[model samples]
Target chain A: MDLVNVISYSLFAIGSFFLVVAAIGIVRLPDFYTRMHAAGKSDTLGQSLILLGLIIHEGASFISIKIFFIILFIFIANPTATHAVAKAAFLSELAPWKKDGGKER
Target chain B: MFLQVALVIVFSSIIALYRAISGPTIYDRVLAVNVIGTKTVLVLVLVEFIYERPEFLDIALVYAIINFIGTIAFLKYIEKGGLT
Candidate 1:
């Protein structure tokens, strides 16, 4: 109805779109490495956007501060966790998927 | 409005759940679980707004921390083939 509500709703829609993209990516990507790219980047962005919308809706308040902390945690931890998983998989000798269907390198 | 958004997120989590359940490798399942965890956080926030209960954000914050820790622990186990 008002400007704030409009902005919050639009942001919520955009965040949801990114979240769905990440989910589809995890399901459709050909390999673990590619899936990590999808999950790590899109999920972080989606969650941050949604949190931002909630913060805007709430305005200045303790809850907004808490939401901000959650955003910070997600920004820091999501990629770190993704990297850890990828590193473990690499260490375990998992091969990346090739476009030409070549043998594991 | 927020309810619709929450429903969309729930649907996405179900899709991620499929990957978690049927992934070809353990890493894929780990990644899907991570995605699902993040989505759950967003869903929690949405539910908080829908119910006018700001306190649930505390639970969402805690869940985010736990999700990150769990992912790292899973990776460590995979790398060492055990959790020692």
Candidate 2:
């Protein structure tokens, strides 16, 4: 309808697209590391974009402030969690998927 | 509208859930679960707008905290082979 609503809806659509990409990636990727790459990076961007759209819709308010905190937390925590999982998998000696039929060096 | 966005997110989450169920390794399942949790947060926010309930934002915030903590805890247990 208005400029703000158009912007917000476009942002929401973009975020949803990223979310779908991440989901498909997790399902289709060859290995755990790649899946984490998909999940961590795209998920963060998707959630941030979606939250940003909602914030814009809400304008300046206490609710938007809380949404900002959620975005901040996700920006900090999502990568950390992904790294933690990858580190644990590495430490546990989980093998990375290699294209060749030989062991990875 | 927000409801359509939420519907798409729910569909994607179901796809993620498939990976969680049939993943080749435990880490894949973990990654899928984390992905789903993040999507759930977005869905929760969209639902708040759909229902015109500002208060549910608090629930979304809390869920984000719990999701992060849960992932970290799961990684720790997986790495050390124990929660302690």
Q: Write candidate 2's Cα lDDT for B1-84 as tens digits.
A: 888999999999999999999987888888889888988898888888988998888999999999989988887787778998
Weakest 10 consecutive residues of candidate 1 chain B by summed lDDT: B75-84
What CAPRI grade goes to candidate 2?
A: medium
Fnat value of model 1:
0.97
lDDT of 1 by residue, A1-105 (tens): 899999988998899899899888888887888888788899889878988998898999998999999999999999998898888889888988889996422
Error of 2 at A6 (Å): 1.1
Error of 1 at B47 (Å): 1.7
lDDT of 2 by residue, A1-105 (tens): 899999888999999999999889888887788788888899899989989998998899998999999999999999998998888889889888889746322
RMSD to the hidden true structure, all candidates: 1.9, 2.2
Here the TM-score of candidate 1's chain B is 0.94
Off by over 4 Å in 1: A102-105
